[model samples]
Target: MNYFFVINARKFKQYLFIALAIIFSAAIVYSEQSNVSVFMNSEPSAIYSVQTEKKVIALTFDISWGDTRAEPILKILKDNDVKDATFFLSSPWSKSHPDIVSHIKSYGFEIGSHGNKFDNYSDLSDEEIRNEISTAHGILTELIGKEPNLIRLPNGDFDKRVLRIADDLGYSVIQWDTDSQDWLNKGVDTLVNRVVSKAHPGDIVLLHASDSSQQTHEALPDIIQQLRAKGYQFVSVSELIKQTQVETTPVEDQAMKQIH
Candidate 1:
């Protein structure tokens, strides 16, 4: 055997041990997100919900253009003792209301990025999208003192490129299975039913903490109780995403995930 190709017995055993260690470490990381290995596309797809059999769901609030309802909504969630909900904050909003931003964090509610400006993501070029997300992620992390790995696009508008860019930047795109339509000033009852009727285990329900969704405040109590009555467990969006490994595209979210 050529000397250069020869493997000493002790060195071969050492190499084998290192190879097994690396494989074990990879398994641990992959296990946390197993669905990624089998189902997620290379470009990454939005996670509308998890695939867990557990009767757990997530309630997410978008805080993009308005702060009029911030305190009130926080009070409502606090009163209900529902602190696990996710709040996606726009950089502009968080900049203006750092105190309120801090308050949300103090409650131990999960916070995610909502982009810096509420731009129509589908209309943005790749660089524009990067600017929007990077700007927001920086501001959020500054206030949060921790990196937030989840993002809900402004107006819920996104495309494959946006998802791919977000994946590259280390963010998982979040969407909702049940939208309250509260942004439309939909009546309280309408908002309530829109969510309660369509909700399922692993569902992500989108609401708003901004003034855009005035009816959300009115409809929230009922939404919480009714879903609870049905045996649904509330979780943060991060927790919801963490529950599943590979995310599959849902039939309905495909139609207008860009339209909010």
Candidate 2:
């Protein structure tokens, strides 16, 4: 009986060692996977390095609902010969403003998904998030005859799961580096100054074009003029991404830079 007990104890000790080794291996793998960084906002400055070598930036707008100033915004962009800009449109907004959508495409601008229902994506489940992104893609593609490859999370809220679903749906998530704060009812001059002071090559700028965004539209000309004076040429978000080197650093360590 003593001999049998000794043998069983030896076997138990071996099994314990094997279990510990497996647990340690799993922990290491989990740590590595969790360390992969993902962008959580829709601002480019959050994820990209601004290139100071050349004068270039992307002007982007988000249209969630209403058409109070869509036409005027379109006209201003057209009049200024601004061919490179991105518009992130909600499905409801697109449905109500078909003419504006047509004009946006006609002007040769990039279209991106703003979400299906204009709800905060952070509050949604993974399946709900996927559906929202996919539905918007389908609508925009039907309207413009080309599928949108980019998406901006509604209200600038996102998580790794949201980004993963977007990637699975064939969209690159975009976050802006510079926000015009036109949505906050700041004066036109104030908005212009904010953009100019933060302007750098390869920066992605955020703006709006709905009725409430008139201040933004009013500030557009000066923002462009001042940035141009500094030798900054505006491009679409897609073009801006193509123009810079993408640095894949951990999202936690990512710091917003003026010009990299």
Give the C-alpha lDDT of model 1: 0.83
Candidate 1: misplaced stretches above 4 Å? 1-41, 250-260
Clash number for candidate 2 = 8
TM-scores for every candidate against the unseen true structure = 0.80, 0.77
lDDT of 1 by residue, 1-260 (tens): 66645667668989999999999999988886776556444547778877888889899988876668888888888888786999999999999999999999999999999998777777788899998999998999999899999999887887777887898899988888887778888598888888999998888988888876777888888888898899988888777777775455733323234444
* lDDT, candidate 2, at 81: 72
lDDT of each: 0.83, 0.77
The weakest ten consecutive residues by lDDT in model 2 span 251-260
lDDT, residue 49, candidate 1: 75
